[model samples]
Target: MSVRARTAIGAVIGATLLAVLPGCGGGTSTGDSGGNSHPKTLTYWASNQGASLEDDKAKLTPELQAFEKQTGITVKLEVVPWSDLLNRILGATSSGQGPDVLNIGNTWSASLQTTGALLPFDDQTFAKIGGKGRFQESALASTGASGKTPTAVPLYSLAYGLYYNKKMFADAGISKPPATWDELVQDGRRLTTGGRYGLAVEGANVSENVHHAFVFAKQHGADFFDASGNPTFTSPGAVEGVKQYVDFIARDKIAAAGNAEYDQNQSIQDFATGKAAMLLWQAAGPNLQKHGMKPDQYGVAPVPVQSGTPGPGQNIDSMVAGINMAVFKNSQNLDGALKFVQFMTSDAEQKKLNGAYGSIPPVKTAAQDPAFSNPELTVLRNTIATSAAPLPQVPKESQFEELVGGAIKDLLADAAAGRPVTTQSVQQRLAKAQQQM
Candidate 1:
């Protein structure tokens, strides 16, 4: 099942909601093994995608089998869909029956850390993953806790950029991909005709939808959080950025109708089916492959800059999107779990996994490997090099998503209905949401 369908089902099956808490016992043996001389078995939970979890298991299974042959440690792998991951982890953590190791969405690191269920990646742990210097600086920051310690190790990294269908651009009489904000808006207007939208963006849920808003805010010199991790979305730049987003649907009529009901899947489907000409989305190479598009059929570019911005270079904010691996604090097989994380993030393994799965490696050296041959991947790599920033790792991160996403959704709905979508109204709504945070 898709993540959205599973999330809808999970919401309906409310009885399965898992309770979250802080802390777990340091030394507990849930897996029938005694003290940690050598664990007989270890459990791993992986998030689902086409062949992602399965491919990782397939590639690593040999190593695992070799480890078993060499050291007598058996690894058990469970594939969990994204929707069920939090619930499963929460339930297991609460019952003291969680998997020994799990892959988590990078943004969830801080929230998951609040449960105190994760083992900290101290200096000793860093050495296991080829040292702290192996991973990208932003990826490292995404895994660490604010005012605390690093809670997880970034397993892979992804960033957002402008993806345009070459055919669509040609059909619209556009010569090249947009590089500046005005050009983007003008192209969007030109592309919106004959049942095709100019862009596909998240509009429904806060979690995914806020990604574009965050990027636009960055272009205008506003961020969701300041250096000290306080909410800072009330600035003029932020308001202008958000207003441009809302105006795409409301004023420009360059987005699909009922966008407020859209999510990642819907947006992706729209783009894939040629109903949209452009998409500002996180790395979707895997999805594009599944949809039968060749790399040559599309063009990827850095997000366009805001017009008249005073920055020395183009302002583009790209969200750090990927999964991280965290060992449960209570696991009896901490050493084994840590070893597995180390193996996964190793330069060799990173190249293998990312090459197979169409994801960028979290480790810097692996990303430069010849195996990652796509030009789009190169664009993404360059975007990360210059403009990538970690999402808010605050414990209240989810709340921020809800606030920003909700406000945007309301503004779009109002604008689509030919109602007012003023800067003051958006500012007020955001201010109220900030206060709640």
Candidate 2:
């Protein structure tokens, strides 16, 4: 997914009661024709995955050209920014007019699947794109609601990791990276001096807020949803978990107060500029490269845990983060769209695209590249494989991002304003968020 990124949402779209929705294609369907005649063109909405909108367009042109050359189908691509993506998809669902294929944040899969607007990637549909076996298992976990057909196919796979400036660590006389939260706070004190903070955070960024909240909540042994799938946002564990994250600036002071206003990747920029000694991000290699930070200047490690080394249960460190490709059920060029999906997910494209973006490929075969063994990427891979967990996949999960994430934003702002953030206050804010849900 740095600069792989989130937020929550309340259900905004109601399933349209019109013509019956199309079915997933048959076992041998070669891009089933949606209209009277086979289609020749497709409109694709690609998520912004590169340095900028223009950059993503430039990076994807070659792949699009190649796909066109072999398949005789033209793809019209629109690189949409993250801020507008979910709303745009919701708009498409309500209007029934949108691009044939689109990239969705993997976390939105379940919520969007409920709209009945996107085509379900059933067994047969997955076969069209080299089978479900081609993708990583962890990457597949957040595709849709549990125990149902996946609504999308994993595209770029990612997991969060702690990225620390080597020079800062060495300068501070700190040896190894922190393995626990206590050590991190201790090291942070040493690193925070001379106008630089020990850590960086994206406070106003709701998506990232929800992400860290989810990770912290997991570490506190809290789940946003109960066993029966009801939201339990104000639970004691949930409140404590969320408060711990805000405390980076609120109480710990490891991050600067100004960080409370940062969104739009400023936290990443702060780390790259040496204004912050460390960063927690998903596949930040590309973002750092954009800022001209050399690979050797920093080292990657698993995010610090509350207690012991990262593992399952309360030790989980990061949420599975990445993009997924979903075909719109109402596409006029269903066959062409499927072909594009196949072209994009093919082993070659997976390697080329993921390499350019500095992300892990969801396709298993594509990950065998020797390049993935780089020290920075190796840490990310291990975290994703062993410690990363997915956020709740319920329909209201997006709403949680909106409500609770916004609450954190306010809390951080309050901290920046020198207001006291007590446990009672944190619980009150969380209770308000739960009431909204």
Candidate 3:
């Protein structure tokens, strides 16, 4: 899932891939494996989703223990902090020493798969876990390069929504949330009074900025990569999409001048503290509660579609987002590792794990449980299936993120500093960014 912490994909691109380890017990498998030759211990690296590592361990250890009892394979669990997880993964990938099974942010799948370090999940391997039909199609499609065998499987699912402050809407004499891009800007203007802004945007956090750029681009009928998997940031539709995003601060003046420095967490804070009327984010309910905002004070809605865009409004929101699990190719216990993956993606475990993290499970049946059937989660779950798109699946996805994200960051800084943000200027910046890639 998209966490509050900033992710570093650059490190992975810079590191060299590790050579395959020899003498590994499990090379490849058919539908299923004969039991391991002897009792085996599996090391698992989990991401920290709770307030602390202790809290995450508290929620996950019981599940791990249950897996051990059911399968007779011991699990060594390590809860890695988000700040350190990427570096650790890169380090392990280079050293050929890492956990048998690990959690990775879905956005990093393509980049990590490029290293030839992860075990690919082919048809037979997928059957070992469960039928591929059990997963949400879009979520499954997000596991790796399109048309190739995926290196991971969706564990938890998440999507972006427009979060609006109900009280602010009422006070501003607005009755409902915006349904189109124009309405969103107009509503933002109406809400801009006193010290509060109509909207909040994360300008400093490159990853967050790039995500918004992707949603807006899709809304305008643009894809970041062509059929041949080449970068297309300079496309007319893509430029228009990003221009509209930057206009929130430059032309509309509904966002604060200093929002250029805000990250996802800061934008969340702005909305929670009533400094902004609306915010675009993904599954921010848990964070809202932590920031002292009551559930009743806010509402969630699908992100507004661009005016005059064709087709239904299902494809104009955030990417089908969340974390996925991958098995290391260099692990000495590939059979046991695959079994652990099966155990983790089981209906029972998906429900338990996603429920603890406040995300929807990837399994359709597990996602349908009453626990996630609430209105808030239902909106995002539907978005994931119908509206969400995957980040570009190129091996150089990290480079795309860095180059595009940096350009947007520069644009935001210029706008925040009261500099010009004309369409021509935006296109020029984007063109420069494309060249860098």
Q: Per model, state how many residue pairs clash.
A: 0, 8, 1
Better of 1 and 3 by TM-score: 3
Instruction: Note the residue pairs that clash in candidate 3.
Output: 1-323
Q: For every model shown, what is its TM-score relative to the native structure?
A: 0.87, 0.94, 0.90
**Models ranked on lDDT:** 2, 3, 1
lDDT of each: 0.72, 0.83, 0.80
The alpha-carbon deviation from the true structure for residue 347 of candidate 3, after best TM-score superposition, in angstroms, is 1.0
Model 3's alpha-carbon lDDT is: 0.80
User: Can you write out model 3's per-residue Cα lDDT over 1-437, one digit (the tens) per residue?
Assistant: 35444543353443333332332222222112443433368888888776568988999999999988988888888898776777677666665667778988788788778767788899889998987888888788779988789989998888888899999999999999998888998999999999999998888777787888988888778877898888899898889888889989988999998888875378888999999999988788887888999989999988778764223343567777788999987666778888999988999999998887778888888988999977678878877877788888777776677788878889989999999998898889889978876
Poorest lDDT segment (10 consecutive residues) of candidate 2: 22-31
lDDT of 1: 0.72
Question: Of the pair 2 and 3, which is ahead by TM-score?
Answer: 2
Clashing pairs in 1: none
Query: Among these predicted structures, which one has the highest lDDT?
Result: 2
